[model samples]
Target: MKIFLTLLTSLFLFFSCSTDDDICTDGEGTPQVKIKFKTFATGKPRTLDSVFVAVDYGAGPVAVVQNTVATDSLMLPLRVEDVPFTDIYVATSSTGNLSQIRLNYTTTSEYVSPACGIRRLYTGLSATLQAPNPVLAVETAQNEIVNESKTHLFLLF
Candidate 1:
């Protein structure tokens, strides 16, 4: 009976404790902002011509896309760290015709895991077109960055 009790206690202690190395770290980072493009005339999904994306409002213009071939959807990381808002620059042509979009959101710190630590969760998103461009309209598909499958914005071109 004494040996059985000692083994049971040891098992309980081992199972109840958690270490950073033992924590699951897969898919622990913040979700990226997703955008889908559509045509204004046809109202159907369409791809743009080598759209260039970057963070042009902060510190400097950090290039996110450098002449990306062609795509109807884009998945971009905001700041990676904790930030209240993000400014995204989208350029369609090589002539530097840029369209600036400002995304404002509220952030909350969340505990992911011991290995991943805390991550920022963005919510209550609001977007504003800072510059005039080919984008005719903007739509918000989802406000929070809870999942990467959710489309945060829809651009009509």
Candidate 2:
């Protein structure tokens, strides 16, 4: 035997040219894609095992888009199967990814000096805040404003 006919012709050409779960080509079949998950902030509607979707693809062979019901800001319904041509890089799993929700804040500015003689008159304030999840907007100068000897500096986001 020629090594058993060269191992049965290389296992019949590697099982007739590789493919599992049905694929007759010239017959057309496997092609399903439906990715839906949106809830970055109250767009309302999300559910994919708790909306932490992440797909730069490469996790294919999945199938279950809307298996019944699961969308209330928990977004998740990804079933991108065998791909004839699909390019997806979905997101929404950044509970703390984008630099922990991106935040850059700065503070420490006060120039209140309009008396120009006794050197005891001040009234200048500047505070800045950047966002991804930053919600700090405060302006205080009430009650004729003494600012209580001014000694409060907090930069939080």
**Highest lDDT, which number?**
1
- True lDDT of residue 35, candidate 2: 26
What is the TM-score of each predicted model, taking all chains together?
0.79, 0.16
Model 1, 1-157: lDDT tens digits are 9999999999999987877657656666777789999888887888987788888545888888876587788998887556778998888876677788888898887888777777767899888888858677677888888768778898888
| Regions of model 2 farther than 4 Å from truth | 19-75, 78-157
Predicted structure with the largest TM-score when compared to the true one: 1
Query: What total of clashing residue pairs does each candidate reach?
Result: 0, 10
What are the runs in model 1 whose C-alpha is more than 4 Å off? 1-25, 80-82
- Write candidate 2's Cα lDDT for 1-157 as tens digits: 9999999999998887644323333313211222233344453334544323232234542322223334432222212233322222222243432211111122222332222211111223222322333222212222111223332222122
- The per-residue C-alpha lDDT of model 1 at residue 9 equals 100
Q: Supply the global lDDT for candidate 1.
A: 0.80
